[model samples]
Target: PGKDKGKDMILLTKMDKRPPNWTFVFAVDVARSGSVSADYSVAIGIAYNSISQEKQICYFWRSKGLKISEQAEEIAEISKNFNHPYLLVEQNNMGQDMIDELTDKYNVNVEAITTGAHTTGKNIKKEELIRFLISAFEHEKITIPRGDEYSREQMSILEDELTKFCAIPTPAGNELFQGVGAHDDCVIALALANRATQTVGIPFAVTLGPGRTQAGGVYSALLQATRGESDIEKMIKLGIIK
Candidate 1:
């Protein structure tokens, strides 16, 4: 089912124009019952690409579990068409199983980026990521692929969820959707992936032996601080401090 070369070519062209070094993280969900008529056996797919100057361009897609095979094929096709080097995936709940199935069956190369020991908590990290995503969306930095009605609807739902996902008075009042089971894991995963991509920088270079490495700018410095990779002393040493 991969005959749509025209559209794929357009996307691939755009991908090529992006930074040569970039990370594409995709988070996908599949239904447990494998039911077709259910509320989408497959939930959503978040594609995040790291760009230069510590920016990440994100794309969100939604589909049914029954169509995951085709959707994954398209995603893989896009990755291969554009020559993306990495695919960072979030391994939580059924995420790992679905990704594993893709790897084993479709031969898609994906890696799991572990969430380090959280000093604050996973929830806090999730919230921070959400905030960043919201800002990115507001600034029109994130793009949703066209012609996908499901993804369009999910984006609307996400907008509503964000509106209600602010600090409140009661302990449970602050929860999105009154603490219902509508977990924002997909959104949170996307945000974390974007953050990770930004920390490493697009076109990330691995210095075998450090001589004269061109460090990223302020945004990278801030992201490094958030990831606990830099301190005041290091910033000063890097010539970022006065």
Candidate 2:
């Protein structure tokens, strides 16, 4: 009787398991025309961490300011390794046709965010855009992840170049670059991606209507989960969150 009771008392149990969340990835490229070369050829990879709002990663790569096709191929290889959804590219001297070819051959989505818009004087308005980017970095709203030594060096060089260049307004009421032959296109492209992601925030599931209908909201729950109480309150007061 005792043995029968012990056997009857045995029980089976199951543990709750949830799948891990995957991060969204975005890649960006910037190019510039070379004086020596007939065509434009330069590239940079800017990556973003969709899971975290604060950390944005950038990778810099450079090639002869010639051979747009070759440069595009390199980007394809990089994209494959990174596995990003879309590549935000600058459409300047290379032309849209080249971009189209690259996208078709590489099976990549390429979005053209800007043409060749360099920093110029009479462009006081342009400074505001630059300031917004700086603010995002200063406020910890955007981040640039550390890269290898070469990448770090390239970033430093670009930062220095950006500082030397200033936007000034001219009599024409248009902005022009104070520093001639200095381009901030690459830096601006990277900044654009970072700004876009942060400004858009992340999407989340919501409930609407009488039934349990799922809806989408701008703010990502992951953002709240990552923030401290003070930060959360600040975001709420700033109307960045609900």
Candidate 3:
């Protein structure tokens, strides 16, 4: 139900549900709506084990001409469909307005990515975002599925953007990254999703540590089940991993 206008769309990987130890993160890059020539607002969903392994892109959506409230409602609906993922919305331009709508109207918990220098929380600069995405790709830590036409088209856009993405040196010695003849909407959304994988703010997921708490012990056991460590395979069968 993500389609609205002819250009607005959503795509999914059609994969089975993830294990309990896996965590889902969605990142959004907002753009001006109501104009075909305007930048497309994009959201990317990534699933990772929150321990060791690559992050998989399971969802892709882009749309234009949607109002701020409409965008927030779409995001909230997607979150519910994906088990209430840890969501990060870029806090720039219409992003702040969308964040407010999502939080207040939809009751969706969200974290804002400060686009500049900040003393608290996740403050991600543009350069950092690009570099983080590059690092993930370089380390082979990101998997983009191309199982279907929609997935293939999105991957092609990602490849095209990365190919034409250029860095221009500013007068102040900083570099600005943008596409030469393309939009960086998908690239920015991907970078934000990669950044989300590094954040440790998932309220429901249990982090590994030496602890005797019931939740911690259960999670540890579930992790062992994934490794075939012992008889702890029952943890997975019990559907307690997620």
Candidate 4:
């Protein structure tokens, strides 16, 4: 739940080694650079206990102005540090290129989450993705990190983004999830991670109480990240979701 925020990157980690008895996954949202309006490329690591139902964010990396190749490299490196958790990348914008690069160049395993019209597999609509995250928060099934200045500021920024996230009616009568002048990259990235905790298959046994087997360990870091926009006012009025 802590970070070393650089000019173009932020990595939050508690230790170099992985934690005990946790399954991990990395979810990414890709964005191109150069334009001021361009969104940030974000990758989040989520850790969970299948039995205890303990889900928390363990790592975060967000950067702007990085090329697709650089982003792929960074993701590969960070995932390696986290024991090479399952990688889920949204197939939008520079997503295909990033996926190609990571698989071909870095030998990384990636599951593509479809978010566009042209998909041979199941597509994750914006509403569905947002709803997944909303359910997680509403049910208190997931948590983000707190404490420390950088972590606190990150949480504040994420909460602010959630508060600003709104659903807009489009000309086609469809709905669009927007941050309404704010950035939703973090929210999307975090949602992707959260989804991983729910959908990905666990390879190890998970039981309650002591003597349960430990799969792989994680750094002792709290969950930290953002959420999507839609009926955010209602969510805020309920508790602000911090």
Candidate 5:
């Protein structure tokens, strides 16, 4: 969306239709600063047909100032509208309040994550979360709305954050992914949605081409995707899956 942005595929492929076998899931990233102060973002990802579980549907909700109950109302509607999506809310800071609002008040069976490591039960770092999404992109296994307004609004935020997203090797040899002066609420939500997709596997398997292993290749694949195409159609043309 900016100068020379498509040169390296800095964005992901965008699509419209969800495959017939896809199932939806919801994820939320609650702000820690204040219930209504910091950014609150949620995204829905659809796990399309295959064992690899490519995410082909992405819808986003984001706002700066909103009470937990207000957010819960919107989430409830989103869940109901999306076939009762499994909700995963980040359980840090005011997030517990959000869960209480959704579960106790809204009657949503929402799941909670203490941190990025909470999902897989193995101390999975936030770095792994960021890298997981990136790896999905590198393997050409993720999709987003092509030009839909609400979806684009969320993808725009996600892309802006991704630009500042980076990793550095620490003295302890652990890699950390962080955005400078930016937040990854949407990105983490998207990642969580995709992880949920992995668990609800479909019957078929998607055969991916050799992944873009090099950084440059990965960037090219991430940013250079087939536009105005459906997921299976796009992958077929890109030679990623057949």
Candidate 6:
């Protein structure tokens, strides 16, 4: 399907309320494709609990109809409306176009990261990012939302994309990971999000003033809402509280 990247190409999904110490980050693995040759998505994730570091949300914005610049504007708007996430853009190939639009034209807050020396000294490696994502899912450090009335039906589509990831052998005798389907924009973008949040350090919750204490009365309820129907306490029951 040749979808047009127009104003109509947008995504809306319900997200949980940000917790006290939630570190919000937005990452982009940019691509320009009018058809299904490739796909691009804007992914959002939140990391909490500085000690344990649990990722609470995994949401994506992708459309075949919208141009890269259009997608950049959409991501900027979403980030601004939802607590201004720390933006990360991969400047490889056509990715620079997305970076230019977000920084030069829109003048938004964004950080550009590339593989190898581009992310030098920061110890941010693509392999590490992918490993972190895999670990998050396997170890139950990441929890995905089931969406709500706004995107109840479309949420599964996004989640389905995650299942298509495959690892292939590279000429260098190392395994390269990617989506085997026409597009793996969601997986790549989410990996970037995890990397961004990881390198930036976990945001800690601070009080307003002296003697002021943070409220935990509704924390559990918020987690329930974020975790959907999952028994979040199972992790605690298993003595995995870190």
Identify the leading candidate in terms of TM-score. Answer: 4
- Cα-based lDDT at residue 66, candidate 6: 68
Task: Assess candidate 4 and give its TM-score to the true structure.
Answer: 0.74
lDDT per residue as tens, model 6, 1-242: 11121112223343346556666667877765645455655455554444677665545666656677677788777676656667888776667788788888777678877755333553345654555565454455555544344343554554555655555557876646666667767767877776676656753222333222233334334433543222223223332221
Q: Give the Cα error of residue 220 in candidate 2, in Å.
A: 27
Per-model TM-score, in order, reads 0.48, 0.56, 0.73, 0.74, 0.69, 0.66
For model 3, which pairs clash?
20-241, 20-242, 34-65
Candidates 4 and 5, the one with greater TM-score: 4
Better of 4 and 6 by TM-score: 4
Question: Candidate 6 overall Cα lDDT vs. reference?
Answer: 0.57
Error at 174, model 1, angstroms: 9.2
* Per-residue alpha-carbon lDDT of candidate 5 for residues 1-242, written as tens digits (9 for 90 to 100): 22222232222223334556656666788766544656665655454556545566556666757767777888887777666667777777778898899898778858876655443562345655555565565566666554445545656666566555555557876656565645767667776666565556641223232221234263445434632223223333444421
Per-residue alpha-carbon lDDT of candidate 1 for residues 146-182, written as tens digits (9 for 90 to 100)? 2345434555554443333432234654322121225
Model 5, poorest ten-residue lDDT window? 203-212
lDDT of 3 at 10: 30
The residue pairs found clashing in candidate 1 are 21-203, 42-65
Residue range 30-142, candidate 2, lDDT tens digits: 34443454422434443334465443344455555645566667767766655544565545445454578677887776665442334343121333444444444434444
Model 3 residue 205 lDDT score:
26
Per-residue lDDT for 45-107 in model 3, tens only? 987776665577778888988888888888998988886778889888888898899989988
Which residue pairs of candidate 4 clash? 18-217, 18-218, 19-217, 19-218, 20-217, 57-223, 144-223, 145-223, 145-224, 165-229
Return the lDDT, model 3, position 160.
Answer: 62
Prediction RMSDs, each to the true structure? 12.1, 16.4, 13.4, 9.9, 8.8, 12.2
State in Å the error of residue 189, model 5.
Answer: 1.3
Model 1 whole-model lDDT (C-alpha atoms): 0.42
lDDT of 3: 0.67
For model 4, give the RMSD to the true fold: 9.9
